[model samples]
Target: MEHTQKLIHKIINLTPLSTAYEHTPKGKRQLECYVKNTCGITAKHLARIYRVRQARQLIKANPQLSLAQLALECGFSDQSHLNNEFNAILQIPPAKYKKLIQQ
Candidate 1:
């Protein structure tokens, strides 16, 4: 249990959950099960939320960064993916969020 919590913390700090699972001592399936049971959210969902959270921080810190660049830095596949996920989580597009912050 202590080890699992450590693993989860490590994963949360790392970008791109796919690669994080690959590096885990246990198989991906076992890690997924442990995370789901312990956290009450699937690892994939947690990863997406963490990515969006990181992107939001970056957006605030550097409001001038382009969406594509933010997407790449946030481990998103593309701007559209970042937009979609960001919208889903925050109910606002990244571009609009940046503009609001800048104003």
Candidate 2:
């Protein structure tokens, strides 16, 4: 339990949208350590959530990727899961966000 708390703390302190997916195993340790200490969340969970954030940035950068593809690439189970988390974390659905960006 205490270990989980520590992991959660580390995750909360993590930097945004790092480009470390291509890092070697050892290089990924910092991310593991951070996620371990902060959320006790599985590495897969962290990866999925982090990738979604990355996808959002990619959308912002290009605005060309379809939402379905974005959700899949981001490791979300589907567009609806992406929608739920996107809305929960950002207070807006992806569709709404895309519309807002184009406005």
Tell me, by TM-score, which candidate is best. 1
Error of 1 at 60 (Å): 0.8
Off by over 4 Å in 2: 1-49
In Å, residue 6's CA in model 1 sits off its true spot by 4.1
Per-residue lDDT over 1-97 for candidate 1, one digit per residue giving the tens place of the 0 to 100 score: 6545756776678546666765667877888888899989988888888889999999989999999999999888899999999999999999899
Q: Give per-model TM-scores.
A: 0.87, 0.54
lDDT tens digits, residues 1-103, model 2?
4433444344333323243433233445665665566667665566556655766786787676788887876656788888888887677888888877777
Error of 1 at 32 (Å): 1.2
* Full-model lDDT for every candidate: 0.85, 0.62
Q: Residue 72: error of model 2 in Å? A: 1.1
Candidate 1 wrongly placed segments (more than 4 Å): none
As a whole number from 0 to 100, the lDDT of residue 45 in candidate 1 is 84
Model 1 scores a TM of 0.87
